[model samples]
Target: MPRFLREYFNRNGVGLGSVMLGLVLFWTIGLIILPQLSMLDFSFRPNLPPPEIGGPKDLYTLENYKYLIFGPEGGSQDYNAVDLKVFYRTLIAAVLVTLFNLMLCYPIAYYLAQTNGNHIRILALMLIIPYWINEILRAFALRIIFGESGVLNNLLVGAGVFDTPFDFIRNDIALYAGLGYAYILLMIFPIYNVIESLDRNQIEAARDMGASWTRIHRRVVIPYAKPGISSGCTMVFMLSAGALAAPQILGGPSSLWFTQLIYQQFNDNSDWPQGAAYAVVLLVTCILLVLALMRVFKVNMGDIGK
Candidate 1:
């Protein structure tokens, strides 16, 4: 730690180093730590009605947490099966979306990195411009595309792919597709940046040795780009898991995301304690998933941003 600090100070100089350190500390404590701590406190408190708000002191209980594991009253043998299922489903869907983005974007990223010309800049602009639009607008656009009278169904009908419009919105397809589209750039840029840094000679040498394209990517490219892969997947998974707008917009009545439930508790139901507990659970789960990914990919904590 001392050596690190010494090196940091030496490289950045004392004035800049101190400023950086101070900003980091402030960000860590003020933004991250304090908010979580306050949420923890709120999670323990009971949800009181407006009429009974000031009537009680220290209305802390485990009711909110219990409501998660067990049912409403906290002592039921059966858990809140609906909430539990939706929570896990949301996590699983987020992972699937991350993997989907990785698969969909990897080739595009590789193409952009490997190719040379003004076309690369054009292609990059096209990728970035969509994301500059509001997320809600993007989601609404997707909603329109997947709606019964939308472009996809019309195309499918025109091509004789389906006799009638398929209910894409009623299912999870639109939700997943919207999320993947929303974060495609996040996945693409990282992998592209890393792959561009790789030595082209390595790929050529492997190709000269009669290595297949698949083999070259597996052996010479993927290992080198693991850090970028990890970073991209981490960002996509975290964002997808926490996403509310896209899901709410694209998901049907049957589709239930954990964030929607949290929103309901905080807004519609006015159960702040329960909402806080759910938020904390989500935050913890995301942290655990991130740690697991870092462990699996052998990435350092500091490498995610790069």
Candidate 2:
């Protein structure tokens, strides 16, 4: 058997490995590498007309990115500045949402993982249930519940809480609420998975040493679950940062999210080069944030799954 395997490897291994390597290279080059180069290429030559299907190449310039990062003078349209603002706002919103999720999810995950009962299962199921619905449908439903004439306001008005309906959509509050609702389940599952695998004896030992609940959590539980918390937060932040539909439907006119700006460039304005540049900026920012979190937490990415 060993001799046969050795012979097969000597003949076919190199060929099979090369084929697999080529396939991977093809996808990497086409999807990620080449597109990034193209974005950089296009960003330099913003105002020039796109090349014909098979026509002369346009000269490269830095006007597009410059216009994006800085406003045009003489009241020229500064879509670039607008795009940059959206990018910054999106990053800030995502970070805040991630922090909120981390604070809320940690205790819940810890409790759920430590406890065992039908009630716990039911609660977990309830949290998981919302994710089963389409995200757009969920966001729309939230909008209805929070809209001026929505049920909450109607109830408040009926109770003489206020004479007029309250505005709940298109504001920063609504945006955060929408993002929180959409991604809370994602935040919970990972933390719960990690906490559930923890050694019960270690917790018990902490308690035996006369440690308070807060102390035990701070010293033992949290340290043990750090990987899970890091993983969950990173996942939620990345998802929320790129989220468009929820913010759009629930955020209203006042809350102009960054993803909307990207969409406008690609779809509304038909400025694919500018849109690609914005996307690249967003991608790089997210990568940096993840790296920062990993460094600060001293988290080994491989431990997230465990």
Candidate 3:
């Protein structure tokens, strides 16, 4: 048996451990893997009318994925520039959101993990209270705040910060803000969980050894928190990139997210194969990102699993 399996059985006893592992296996295969496999299979098949699903026309092909580059029109265009641009922008925004949350959450996570009193409770309550509301509602609330006649614009005008309301919506500012806020907790909790287990004596020793705060965090804290940090990055990037409601509520005229394109393929175009292909592309990209992060941080699957 694997060492982790051995540890699990030792900790939980064989019966409970077996049950736990079995449940996990069932959930992974049933909920996650099976759905992905279905989608993958669908992605390779041609889009056909309901009656033609199992007919001779419903053959497997790479034409669906090819449309991502050549487009639905296909054959004439140099490339599907519009969809490619949206995909690029979405990825860039996701990366920015991940970095933004990482920076914003690290200090708070550090404070929460290290603090030893009622302060932790108070801080945690403050963070959790806002998130208790539905995510869509939270996004709509931001849309309200950033609207032309919104509170932020009114306050800015009143304070003479700007002569007119800034176009936060059209400028994609609201989308960025919404995505960042939506995934902040994902970043915070992971870092906090890992950092909380770190020995304070190591920090004290670093301080005693005359390591500056920046050096201490760079050399000690961040290294130790790699697993959590990697996990948080993975979650934030994937969630932000795949977000539907937040993008819809907060995106402006010019903000074209890649997920919206996939949504359009499915709903508006009614092209299931095309949509599945797009989803597969996105899923593959996210998986590649996970692999890259693991490589960059020297983090193994075992570390994240822990």
**lDDT, candidates in the order shown:** 0.91, 0.82, 0.92
TM-score of 2: 0.83
How would you encode candidate 1's per-residue C-alpha lDDT over 240-285 as one tens digit per residue? 9999999999998897999999999999998888999999999899
lDDT of 2: 0.82
At residue 131, candidate 3 shows an lDDT of 88
lDDT tens digits, residue span 92-190, model 2: 889999999889889999999999899998999899888889989998888888888888889989999888877777456667888988888778888
Which sections of candidate 1 miss by over 4 Å?
1-21, 49-60, 74-77
TM-score of 3: 0.92
Order by TM-score, highest first = 3, 1, 2
Q: Which is better, 1 or 2, measured by lDDT?
A: 1
Off by over 4 Å in 3: 1-22, 74-76
Q: Residue 150 in model 1: shift from native, Å?
A: 0.5
Q: After superposition, how far is residue 252 of candidate 3 from its true place, in Å?
A: 1.3
Q: Candidate 1: give the clashing pairs.
A: none
Model 1, TM vs. native: 0.91
Candidate 2 clashes between residue pairs 3 or more apart in a chain or in different chains: 44-61, 68-80, 170-251, 170-252
Measured by TM-score, the strongest candidate is 3
